[model samples]
Target: MWRVWLLLVTLLGAAGAQEGKVGPQKKPSPQNAPSGAPPGAKNPCESPVLDVTPKPPPTAVLDRESASNLARSMSRLLAHQQERSAQDRAGALAPSAAALAKKVIDENNGIHAVGVGLPQINLGLLHFRHHVVIFQNNNTAYLEHYWKALALSWNHTSGVWVPPFLECNPHSTEIWLHGFAIALTVEKQRAVAGIFRPLRLDQCDSMMAKLFGGPHRCDEETTKCVSEEGRGFRRAGYRCECRDGFYNPGAPPSWRGFPGEIVELDPNDVHRCTACPEQCNTCNSAGKCGVQRDPLVRGALLATQAACMLITVMMAAIVFKQRKCKTIASGMWTILETILLGTFLLYSTVVVRFFEPSVEQCLVEPWFRELGFVVCYGAIILKLYRHLIEFRTRKAHRWVVKDVDLLKYLLAMVVAVLCYLAAFTASSLNFIREQYKLVRTEETSSGQLFLACKPLWWDYVTEAGEMLILVFGIHLSYASRNAFTQFQERRFLCAAICVEAIVSGVFYVLRAFYVTTLHPDYMYLAYFVRSQLTSTVVILLIFTPKLWYQHKQVRSLAQEFSCRLPVDAFRAGEAGALTADGDVAELNLADMNPEDIRAELKRLYTQLEVLRNKTLRADNPHISKRRGGRKVAHRRFSLQKKGSREKVRRLVSLP
Candidate 1:
């Protein structure tokens, strides 16, 4: 059985070798396989060996499809990369263009670009790029030549080449950039070596011919050369000095060829110049320049000064002439003088300084002017008090009284004080409280506040008070015109009372209504004008010669009346006329002789003695011997025939 099995295994191994080469299920021979091997290739337990064909390599069509899919993926990646590259290029260019624009703006300071048409050049390329290709087109030549001509012209006129820098261009950026680069190069060359020695006119003409491809022909009459009109290209004019207020547009051309060949031109010389008007100039010469100064302005100033001087001198003269006229009215005049002087000084300062008043300054100026009003009015108040006292006491002759209307005077004084206080309060309240808050919050200063808070109201009040005082004083003056005599005194008193009533009514209306018509402070000019007018009225009323003459006539009449009575009695030869007049008249005993006066006095004494005795008897009626006393008288006569008749009459009446 072993021989048979060995023989079978040998045959099966031979078969497996054949199957391994030709079938898919074949396994490697025992020599090729490692470790454990099947015990026998022809084992009955093993499945039967099957012959299977080997798989073929993939076809060319499948290979072609795979290659196509891979190629499509690669194409998508390349397209994405190209898009990213384009975006990057645009981003980089945008910033570069902006930077170039900013650089041009900075170079030109703040001048705005009116037109632009150019791509910005990258300045950084010069550093990294190994080589640069400078393209020279016809545009470059045109720009270079034009700029050169302008530079030459500028140099000829101003004695310095006005270097051109980057400016807005309507063409392409490349053209402008190239043009500016050339200009910058020329400027740099000038800075290093100074400009090529100024070229003579002939040399400049030759250079222009070469650049413009034509010879330049200058017009002898017009002084302009052949060039395009209405464009920047223009020929240089003859070298000339510019007139006042004018300047040459360019440098002067250098002298060359013929000596003194260059002509001089005046830049400001008018084309058909006419002389300034004679009124404007002092010069009478036909061709001479006239003075431009305004004579009217000077005349106005001079006139103002003259007027001020006249007023001042007149005031001084008045003051000097009326020094002794210290009447209440005269005091007002003095106050007026002071006011005029102060105002003159203030106005003079303003005129000299040419100050223009703002609202605040206006207000303050009035306040300053009002100081005079207060002082003048205060003096008038005092004067009024004196007049009032003189009238009341019948002491009109006493021009100066030690004591006057104390109460009214005190009230006036109080009002004056209140006026000042109110002024101070108003000014302070307006400025410190109202304006100060506004100023502080707004961070402003006091320049205007000082002006706005001017004491106009204070001045108005002062003027009003002064007016009142004047009226009262005038009334008192009228009333006291004949205080020394009863009849004239009564007349004056009545007249004064009437005047006072009228004045009071007028003043009341003015003070209560007119003054309240507007804010007193705001209407300073009006107030000043009104006050002056009122003063004028008062002065006219008080100083009228007619009124003064009438007063004098009344006084004279009173004096005549008082003297006439005594003179009449004396003329009639009436005795005791002097004595009856009063003690004052008796004190004047010089009119009578001592002896005649003594005799007259003695006779008068004897008569007085008799009259005194008769008066004593007349008091006793019982001594008359009436009928009612008859029985008593008979009894008394019988009983005492002796006892006494006188005693009997009295005794009988008693019984």
Candidate 2:
């Protein structure tokens, strides 16, 4: 090896010094030298027969004139190829890696570089990083691959480039395994560690390992790493083995320290395992743990939501049917309808959350759970406060807002809420935005990943709004608790809002503090409690009594209407209707949740107010220019001065 280098160095010096001329040759080191080979094995690095060692002379490589001509010819070749045909007019074709590597080995006197190098060398025609083996006469090299083309960065020097070393013929039958292919059935990219050849897997493992104390591991992603007690070759108490039905095709003797270790060259370097082929699942390496979801839990939620929605719809229908009753429609029946809608929306949130928290589900979730509260509870609080005002103003003997006036106030409040929600949704509901999403997913350490749709950071916005409503409702409920207009309705309203506040507070607290450590409580109990609060509190406590009272009073009231009782006679006849004796002893307000007679006046007032005059024409009827207006209200009833007032007194007296 030294004799060959001496001859090349002499030629390079002589040719570089003067005008292209041969120089005086140096004496050879000896007849025989260490060629980095076994005592009897033939060194594939050198040609067996060629006198010139089968390569262009080093002097020709150094010749400046020859290099200039080579550059010009390369340019002309590119131009000529471009002009060959329109089929390749887009651009010149790229040379395949096999052709480039074969040319490299042929030019280097058949010397082959080791498995690994800096890939940058493959960029130019001067040298390459990968190994290329050419067997018999063939168009392509038998093997051309970059196993572990690596790089070195200078620690001390400011700027330096490390040149690669051509260590040995990587494909030499005695040295390396070549052209081994790994087959994968499931995961495609996990074709393992045999990819790095000259790199020695141990060195790479040490570089990337963060373990403080442990056996250096093989790549688990691509190989089946396991503990072992016996060590051999480069393995640290463990050996690399090909899976059954898969064998090392071109491995060095004894499979690089398998059960029978025959490590002839570079025995200390780590030997990596190669996969069998792409079509084989025999070597399937699974690194991920199995994940499972509990179908029973999700099914429970789905059933609960479906049941609640049905009950809410049925109750809403009953309320609409009983809308004509004064107690049922007290303080605007529209408010009850709005509350039902909001409660229905709240129930629907569970259905929206039935799926995993995807972009679409997360988007719809906020509208159902958050804005639904705004619509439902917003109506409740406003109605409670309106009741508070009505009670006070009635005690003061003053006229206050009518149903339409109250509705307009509700519209204003809703519009403001809509504005705030609109701004929030537009800015926050961007499909990808993390904030403003209603529910977020979390995972467990047991490889069981479950999405809770749990409370997020943005839930505070909606929560805060709900808190304000509940607080306002509490205050309104307390102030109106003693009102006499709607018997027991004030008490029922107070109970409903208080129950809501309690359930919401408890649900949120559990979700915040203990739900993660104790889940399915949040999924089952917490969600059920919060979602069904309206059904229990508002529907049962507030509306059920009203419906029952309407059912009881309807029969009696219908008989009175048929008899055409005068207004004054009906108002004065509560004693006769209740009992034979003119006494209040028989009527128990607490037990009966008795219907309020004065509420009948308010119901009549609403009826007359619908045909009221415009503000500017306060003394006259507010008639429209349309061809047909509410004149049916005129022809069927007297519109004479004080006629509407006299009519209302007559209707209210019937209660």
Candidate 3:
């Protein structure tokens, strides 16, 4: 056995070695033959003369083909070289340059560089020759012009043109200082025009002065300048100009604040800010221009919205639970509510991300927006169905179709159908097709469509209809509550419905008016408070002791009233009772004793017996009437005796 195992192991080892040596199979190489050889020429391994070159073609043909091939090869080689050079250049720039490039690309696929240090007015020109070639087939001229002009003003670059500075020393203080001066000058110009622009002058000078005595002025004009009484650059006929924060000594006295300090443009003069022709605030805002906009702001807003939705959903759940609102039908309502909230959040986020009101403002197509409305409204309709079911049944715990107000429900259904039809009519088949086209063309993983479409009023209308359905349906539910419960239930339901309606209505109206009314910042808090109130109302209505106590009191009162009714009176004037000329005397309880009660009982028993006998006999109506007449005679006698005795007893008691 040992030998057998050893043999097997040895064989396995050998197999593994052979596998390793062989590695993976290699692909076969093409066979080579001498140029101009016959199609069936012998393989080079089989013939010694198989490698000979073919005779050259005629000079003219050879030259033409050679020249063409050479030109094509050179073109390809040069293209590759240029691509590598461009990549290398990009790699060599600071990481900020790449970010700036990406920003430019995002803006318009254009590129420019702004100086980073003091006096950072230097603008680095990007070679547009390559961009021109690359975007020749695309519309890129506008992009180039936009970036060039923006960079020129932003970087405070001198002259209308950008200069190539491949060997420019980025760390040079002189260049930075000059850039700073240019930036200051540009800021001063913008400030005069009422544009709230940031001052980019390096604070290093002041900071360093505090650390180390400020260095001598490096600029030629400022180097020789000293204190006003001292003989320096000013003594030699050189005028000294202070930095942005410092005032010129010889200038007419101005206020003691920083001479060139930039201030925010007042709203009154907002129109004068030339940078933003019609909207000065747009340019002056933090993310508007000359300031870094935090990407995290969008993310944070989205998170806040998500949190708000979560809270709202939780509140809704609490409300439903507290209301003791049960029913298999309500499950659908919960699901629809969840879907609505989720979709709302998703839609809002998408809008924030891709909806650039100024540039790509029209990308969200009308049909897509309409679809969003449909989804929201559909949720509302579902909620309405739940309310209708609950109300019509008059049962909170179980769903019954018969309980719903069929008329109102049918009306709602009709409205819903009409809304759906409207949505269908307004549907953008073309937009959907375009979305499909985008999917096929773009390499994106998100399956969302309508990224590039424009929003329309129809979308808002669909949403409005949906909200109305929900509001009305809730109202119906409140109305269906028992009259006793109506006050509180109606108030609560009305408040909730009103809130939803008002918010939704206002949102639509603002959207219609193109106003930014909804802010993500406030959504969470608003929804949270609303949800809490709704939950509280639901809880109070569902678990209030007053309702239960009232119900019990009502039942007790009914029983007491029923117990007090005269049982004998109900039996009076019947066929079994005394009937003299079809008139019956009233019973006197004063004379009635245990015997009388017994007698009355016996009479009733006897009458019941006679009726049973008659029934068994299958008597016709006349026969039955005769039998009943006999029983009536017996009851009359007994009642007369009882009444007389009762009168005697009453007289005795009175005396």
Q: Of the candidates shown, which would achieve the greatest lDDT relative to the real structure?
A: 2
Q: Give the poorly placed runs of model 3, Cα more than 4 Å off.
A: 1-296, 309-399, 402-453, 467-471, 474-490, 515-655
Please report the candidate that would top TM-score against the real structure.
2
lDDT of each: 0.34, 0.47, 0.34
How high a TM-score does candidate 2 get?
A: 0.42
In TM-score terms, candidate 1 sits at 0.25
lDDT of 2 at 454: 50
Clashes of 1: 19
Q: Determine the C-alpha RMSD for candidate 2 after optimal superposition of all C-alphas.
A: 21.2
